[model samples]
Target: MTQDKLIRRVLKPVVWVLCLGPLGGLAWLAYSGGLTANPIEFLNRYLGEWALKFVIFALAITPLRGLTGWAGLTRFRRLLGLFAFFYVVLHLSSYVGLDQYFDWNAIWLDITKRTYITVGMVAAVILLALAVTSTKGMIKRIGGKNWNRLHKLVYLAAAAGCLHFFMMRKGVQLEPLMYGGAVLLLLGYRLVGYLKKRRRKSRLAVA
Candidate 1:
């Protein structure tokens, strides 16, 4: 088979595993009694970590396509983006439903009173918006340029998410640091690209 066909053939199963493998792993751990005594905390942290991981993967797509010359990878970005939202929803549900015992009043108070929770809620809202507008019909209605500008909200969401994680931790743990560093790298890459394009446009204007 040609390289293109080989990639296509491998892509579907790889995406499935990448998407569902974490859930399977969680289930396996749960079945094995690997989750800590505080199962709620375990679920919350696990789902949140996976959600952030998916966001990082979504952010990496453009850079990976540029570096690897795999243009077809962009085709999977929407799916990955939705997966991020899926994990995020799971994370939030774990908190509100399991942790709070579905106490609407307490949840509302916590959201209002806690800065990190407020930040996380904002990020979730932005992710929800992005997910809802991921369809091609919405893209047609919104126009690509507008859609792109709106989607740039993902960077902000990631920042808020990292801040949420960092603040939620009791101390300066390595995990939060690692997630923060990865987000910084992704944002820094985009920043450098933006500057380079600006310089190129400036040179063209002078010419």
Candidate 2:
């Protein structure tokens, strides 16, 4: 098989394995006394980190394709985005189910009253909506133009997610700061590209 086909063939399974394998490994660590104390916090941290990582993955697609000219990466964006949703769900579940004991009212109060939680919840909702409508059937049903418009919301979702992470912590941490920086740089690349295109168009019009 050609290199491209080989890469494509292995991509899905590899991503799935890498994503879930860690969760299983962590669970095993907890069961075997590695995370004996405060396993719930460990689980929450893992899920939260994955959610932000997935957001970064989703955001990286356009920049990656733009920089490397590997258009095929666009095909994986949906899967990456859905994985972000999965992690966010897991993160929230860990809090609600494991932490809060399924207290609906308390959860509701936390969501509404807590600024960081509210931002994160809103971002998650937007990601979930985008993921649900990501399929071709939904695209056809919604119409391509409308779908495109809706998908643009991913940028806002990503920004909100980053900010949510930034605010959730009491003090600045290097790791999350790095994630935010990467998001900013990736987005900056797109902005610069747009300006370049605009400048070229203006120069042509003057000529």
Candidate 3:
């Protein structure tokens, strides 16, 4: 098969299944009563961590494609981003419906009073906006330049997500720090690429 056919027929389906694996595992755990003593907390944290992981994976796609010269990677970017948003929604739903039992008053209080929760909510909102405008129709309607500018908010969303995970943990934790470091590295890569592009443009303009 051609590379394009291989990606479309084999790789995409494999990735799709892998992305759903976490949720499947979670479901199995719930059914088997393997969520330990605090099922609600376990479910919330599990889904939230997967959401962050997907976000990082989505962000990594650009850098990876640039470095490897595999443009086909771009085809999966939107799919990964949508899965990130899917997991984020599942995370929030678990918190609201399972953990908080849909107590709007209490949920509002938590959002207002809890710093980590506030940060998480901000990240969720940004992801939602990106997901909503991810379509080709939205891109055409908004214009490519404007769409690019709006989508840059993904960096901020990823940063806030890292911060939220860091703050949610008690005291200091290695996992959150590692995730935060990964995000920093990805952001640094993008910044360096942006600077290089600007420098090249400036030299061209001068020439």
Candidate 4:
């Protein structure tokens, strides 16, 4: 089979199932009474952690593609991004519906009072914008250049997410630091690429 068919017909389905595996595990845990004493908190944290992980995975795709010369890797980026957003929605929903019980007042207070929640909300908003404009129709309507510019905010969202995770945790934790380091490395890679491109263009112009 052709590469495209392999990706579309076989790999995509496998990846899709793999993406849902976490949620399925969560469901099983819930049913089996394994979510710990604070189930709501556990659910929120678990979903939020997975969301951030998917976001990092999506961000890594471009760099990975460039390094490996596997352009087909781009095909899965959107799917991973959407799953990141999906888990983010579930994380937020758990906080709002299950934890807060739709208490808008308490929610607003938590958002205002808790720095981590505020940062997380900002990240969520950025992800929401990216998800909304992820469609082909939206891309055409916004123009390719504009859409690309808007999507660059994914880096900001990722950074904010890392910060949110860091601040949400008590004391100095290793997990958040590791996540933050990964984001920094990814951002560094992009910055180096941009600088090299600019230098190459300048040399061509001079020549």
Q: Evaluated with lDDT, which candidate comes out highest?
A: 4
Task: Go through the candidates in order and give each one's C-alpha lDDT.
Answer: 0.92, 0.85, 0.96, 0.97
Spell out the clash pairs found in candidate 1. none
Model 1 C-alpha lDDT per residue in residues 81-110, reported as the tens digit of each score: 899999999999999999999999999998
Query: Could you give candidate 2's per-residue lDDT for residues 135-168 as a string of tens digits?
Result: 8899999999999899888878878888888887
Error of 1 at 172 (Å): 1.0
Model 3 ranges with Cα > 4 A deviation: 31-33
Residue range with the least summed lDDT across 10 consecutive positions in model 4: 39-48
Candidate 2 local lDDT, residue 25: 77
Q: TM-score: which is higher, 1 or 2?
A: 1
What is the Å distance of residue 180 in model 2 from its true position?
Answer: 1.0
Q: Which candidate, 1 or 4, would have the higher TM-score against the true structure?
A: 4
Error of 1 at 182 (Å): 0.4
- Please, what's the RMSD in Å of model 1? 1.5
* Candidate 2 vs candidate 4, TM-score winner: 4
How far off is residue 112 in model 3, in Å?
1.5
Top TM-score: which candidate number?
4
All-Cα superposition RMSD per candidate: 1.5, 2.0, 1.4, 1.1
